[model samples]
Target: MRERTMNLLKLNIVVLIEKYKKVTDVARELQLKQPTVTFHMKSLEEELGVPLFHSRKGRIVLTEAGRALYPYAQKMLSLHNEALRTMEEYKGMGRGTLRVGAEPAVQSLMMPVIADFLKRHPGIRIEVQVEPEQKLKALLMVEEIDAAIIEERAALELPLAFERWNEDEVVLICAADHPWVLLEELDPGQAGQERFVRHAPGSQLDRIGQAWADQHAINLWSPLTAASPEGVCRAVRAGAGVAFFSRKALAGNEANEGGGIRMLKVPGLEDPRLQLGAAYRKEGSPASLINEFVHFLRTCAQI
Candidate 1:
């Protein structure tokens, strides 16, 4: 029986090349000469007895075999890093970094909870990136970040699992001086008459708001569409238009503060709720710190 030689370095080169889709790019990223990267790739293809990439006009695209092997290579690299961390921990070093992505609205409400989490796991360094929902999902799919907190769940199509951390009821908010503030409840017939501020189209909140209005036969006279929840809130506060927000978002503000804002229940919109959660790639090894963070978020919501 012939013993097959397994070259880990060659495997890493193949993975890097496929990930970057160009030898020169991979070389620059790895801080190695382009020739060196190319050499390893060629050697790996030979050792595997198959071509790993299809080269076309200097662009490299992964072959089927390459695509199949990429995840295993990633797992191997992850294990190697984990082994190094274990050794460091054995040598009295007990610190690591956690990269997290979050949608904009969650940044304000979720950060305090995350702070409590960091206090408990003081040795785990934390980094947070604020991104839109789609971009956050992209980062998670590419393994760029360990986890993310997102508002609208519909847009993401990644092979990731989510655990609901908190749920909040969506409410219509308007400046206290707005005409709608004087009404006991919103009337769908009058909806078309009022200037409205809302999240941009395709946002989870926007979709929900639109659906609710449609169901009630309300035609919104949208005067402002903002990309972020805070933007919507600010616009409403400035008397630009009425906007829908989660009750949790407006919890701290007094009704009359800054000339105030009124939180009105959308007439006929039942349980207009948003579920906020932590999401991560389903196949990867779960980080203990991330698991702990999820647990903390759950506990906070339960309280």
Candidate 2:
């Protein structure tokens, strides 16, 4: 077999097999003539000295050798893009793209930091993907996203590099006039008996609240559930029930707009804080931008 090069692969095999699956369609997608696309395909097969593609069911499909090379082609393309961006950065162009992933629960916090980062560096482009922690980690692993912001607990469990950048306090909130608001501090026993307005099941707060309940042997009776922090706050303000919410979600005002809601202090609870962290793969993408964005995230947490 002859020496194989990236130029020989050139993503033609990928689009032909995975996307278009036809010479004409691949040609149109690549903005090249059909013959040119066919030439590239044949060249790739000849270089590898293997039948990478065969016609079956009227569609172009990859043979075993071609299927095995698909992932490497994807990585090579991703690395090529990254190398271009890195070169642009080193040239002092001060312009590149950063793809960031975050869990939906922390978007409110993540957006502000993203906005501030763009304001400081207008030339750079940032794409934000909001997904669950597991999805975000998968995207990071595949080089689909440059970095991820997730709960510290979830981030720690992943094999990627993580930095614990912030801590979000979980404060018990109730309607302003609720009787619990009058108490300086509520014990676990008092909290256990109250009807809690819980966050939707599977949410970060919901998990934390459940674990807290189990550790204290408190069987929480949640008669109200909201899918979002804002919804939970609205429910608490309307006197539906009490809930534990992140302080950041409350926007740092315990009074919560005209004193409609109040934050309560709870004692004897093992943990009342939700930790947040930024995670990223150690290689195969731009590191500088990821680090800079994480710095902005930390700065935003301080504010």
Candidate 3:
């Protein structure tokens, strides 16, 4: 039989077991007549030389042999989807669903990029999932997402293709009129004495900030924590305490008179900048799609 015939068998079996249990329902779902579905079901069982399905209490159910083959059917269908998506990439950038993963810290940077991408490629579908650093990497590795925007350092350690996507200036922010504002540069030692608003524990920004502090042997007196960059910015503006934030967090409000946040420079704060990157699995990904998206990312980074 042809490969298409085998695929048909796979599809019918999968839908029967996992989706619609009745042959009529399966036929309706597949847009085939009831007899056609029954024919395929009988054909599959004969080819396997085993009874694959049987009726139980007027409901069609998979037999032991059918259950054993279900996983293989699922895998075949998944591969089929990947194949279709890969082929779609070659036709043109005009169409295809682009699934992207992003860490929370980079979300602000992603919004404009995604918006512009959709406008330029109107037929393309885009799905954005916000996940933690490790989870984002996990999704990329499994091909759940076509690409991700996250810290370059995090992507560096993974087996992925990385392109520096953006420059996220990690700066210390406090109320505009705070005493430290008048100083040429805040002393690292003084940071130990002031009340600090910290990024939530275990976050990428939190970890990087902590590592920098440890490197300089400076201890921050943090009694408050914010879960997001925006939250941290709001807390700092409200005079909760000074906190570290990416320039993205200061969007629309940075250096403006009405925005009560001031970006500060701390002496010995070496390279207080995080490099964000576009990352994707090095193999088994739609290369055309990734390349096209990365091109947009590079363009967006310059603006």
Candidate 3 deviant stretches above 4 angstroms: 1-90, 253-257
Taking all chains together, the TM-score of candidate 2 against the true structure is 0.63
lDDT of every predicted structure (CA atoms):
0.74, 0.77, 0.76
Q: By the lDDT metric, which is better: model 1 or model 2? A: 2
- TM-score, cand. 3: 0.66
How many Å off is the CA of 225 in candidate 2? 2.4
Q: Per-residue lDDT for 1-303 in model 3, tens only? A: 533345645554555655667877877777888887788888777767788888888878888888887878888887888888867655688667778988777887788889998898897788999776777888888889999888888888888888787787777778887898888767778776778888766566787778878987878788898776767777788888987777765764433348778787655677777788888875645666678888888876753
Highest lDDT, which number? 2
Of the candidates numbered 2 and 3, which has the greater lDDT value? 2
Task: Return the TM-score for each candidate structure.
Answer: 0.62, 0.63, 0.66
- The C-alpha local distance difference test score for the whole of candidate 2 amounts to 0.77
How do the residues 184-225 of candidate 1 rate in per-residue lDDT, one tens digit apiece? 766767765678887866555677778887887778888788
| Residue 77 lDDT, candidate 2, scale 0-100 | 77
> RMSDs, each prediction?
15.2, 12.9, 11.1
Model 2 C-alpha lDDT per residue in residues 1-303, reported as the tens digit of each score? 557764824564564567767878887877888888788888777777888788999989888888898888888878888988878774453777899887656778777778878898887898998775667877888899999887778667678887676778877888889998677668999999989998766667787788888989999999888866777888899988999877777874333677698877655666677778788877746677777777777666652
- Output the TM-score of candidate 1: 0.62
In angstroms, the error of model 2 at 237 is: 0.7
